[model samples]
Target: MTKIPTALLLTCDAQLVEIDLPFGHDCASSAERRAVLRAALRCDRFDVVALTRQWDMWIDDEGLYNHPVNPAATALAQRFGFTHQPYHGPVLLTGGPDAQGNTLPLLRHQVIGLFLTLQDL
Candidate 1:
């Protein structure tokens, strides 16, 4: 079967994870969640394209540095190893199939951003 990369929505609570990570469950504590986050980010089993909101508010594409990035988000990105932002922002998160029909990395970092997006959503 063709695998569609799953996006791990990073959040501080439980919203709707069954839609993506069926094998996962609600975390009991912040420490537990962080542990899971670290493992997911560094898992060698597959690539994880991290995602998160860098800025508190939307900004122009060129204005990435013009505004202050969320310190928490920045720390999370750095903690996960996202050398730079990869997904489009200002309200745009697009995706498509891989050439090999292989699923993309379950978004662990953007999954980081993703976790937030799902939280906000």
Candidate 2:
């Protein structure tokens, strides 16, 4: 079975504010994923998390400067060996996949929570 991709937005306090993209999204297309991400950025939140079989990214404004990775995101990514890519104004947290070709949901949630916590600081 193909795993569905999902996106999540979290408040600055680790609360789940929104599910930007729910399961069953057309994650197979990078264009579709980018479109969803662009739409999610229009919201008032500073943190967004994308979870898919292709890639997983933790988007946050904190990593816009000299740091290639957001501190909190780095720590979390280190735990899972995820690669940190820099985005225009947010950090792109990318990582390896599991057996199902999906980035683990637990890791996605944990990364979002961590990003939110760091934003509060």
Candidate 3:
């Protein structure tokens, strides 16, 4: 006889079904992945995704960074438009993509990390 592993599945009627998947004989993954699941994000007044990892801050579609860990990213930020704090502080909220095709940044961060991607940086 083949023994199949089953889980205490929660049904729509709020009942637990102690059996294999209702639709599948065996549908399970050997590897496990972790994720930070939250009911909602702590957004500011503008509803932009706030940088709740720390103090009052927010990130944006623009590649600008107040303090970047990657040297190349830092250089790129400066090239794009990055000035010292107090000099270039947060705009609270900005209207993106002006006539010059430049995105308005969400100013609020101390140290930031950059990721290598295929999309427009």
Candidate 4:
């Protein structure tokens, strides 16, 4: 048995909100991911969103960070056009093109990390 890569969603104050370790072909859609963020922003319990897999961390930094957007995430952001400013931040999407031109997202057991800052909202 292999371990699934863990993804942690942390608030600006560094509170853990969600931890996702998706299973085979069960990656969350862009919309679903956005919804989680939206709900968090609305709660006011969190101001910053930080998603990390292992050592890779994506921080919106109150919309200050210019983190490179993931190609597949960019497409989903374009499609939804969420009004929230942080939604303009990078998202988590599946089926990204690989180096060999294979349309695969991350490894099945790999986690997708996404981040947004509610201060921009």
Best by TM-score: 2
lDDT string for model 1 (1-121, tens) is 5444343332222222322322223445434533443343322122223233231211124424333333333444445565466322122121222454322334434345555654453
Better of 2 and 3 by TM-score: 2
Residues forming the 10-long window of minimal summed lDDT in candidate 3: 32-41
Give per-residue CA lDDT, model 3, range 38-108, as digits (tens): 10111122112222222112222231333123333223234444533211112121223334533233222
State the lDDT of candidate 4 residue by residue for 3-116, as single tens digits.
432344444433444434233333465445444544433331223222222122333434334333333323333434532443323332323334543223344433333323
Computed on alpha carbons, the lDDT of every model, listed in order, comes to 0.34, 0.43, 0.24, 0.35
lDDT of 2 at 112: 57
Candidate 1 residue 76 C-alpha distance from true site, Å:
2.3
TM-score, structure 4 vs. true? 0.27
- Candidate 2: pairs in clash: none
Reference-based TM-score, model 3:
0.18
Candidate 1 clash pair list: 9-115, 10-115, 50-109, 50-110, 51-109, 51-110, 51-111, 51-113, 52-113, 109-112
Report the C-alpha displacement of residue 7, candidate 4, in angstroms: 2.9
Model 4 is weakest, by summed lDDT over 10 consecutive residues, at 44-53
Prediction-by-prediction clash tally: 10, 0, 0, 0
lDDT of 2 by residue, 9-121 (tens): 43232334334342233556545545555554442234544444434655644435423423444443444454554243333333435665543333455555545644664
TM-scores across all candidates? 0.24, 0.35, 0.18, 0.27
Best-performing candidate as measured by lDDT: 2
lDDT of 1 at 29: 45
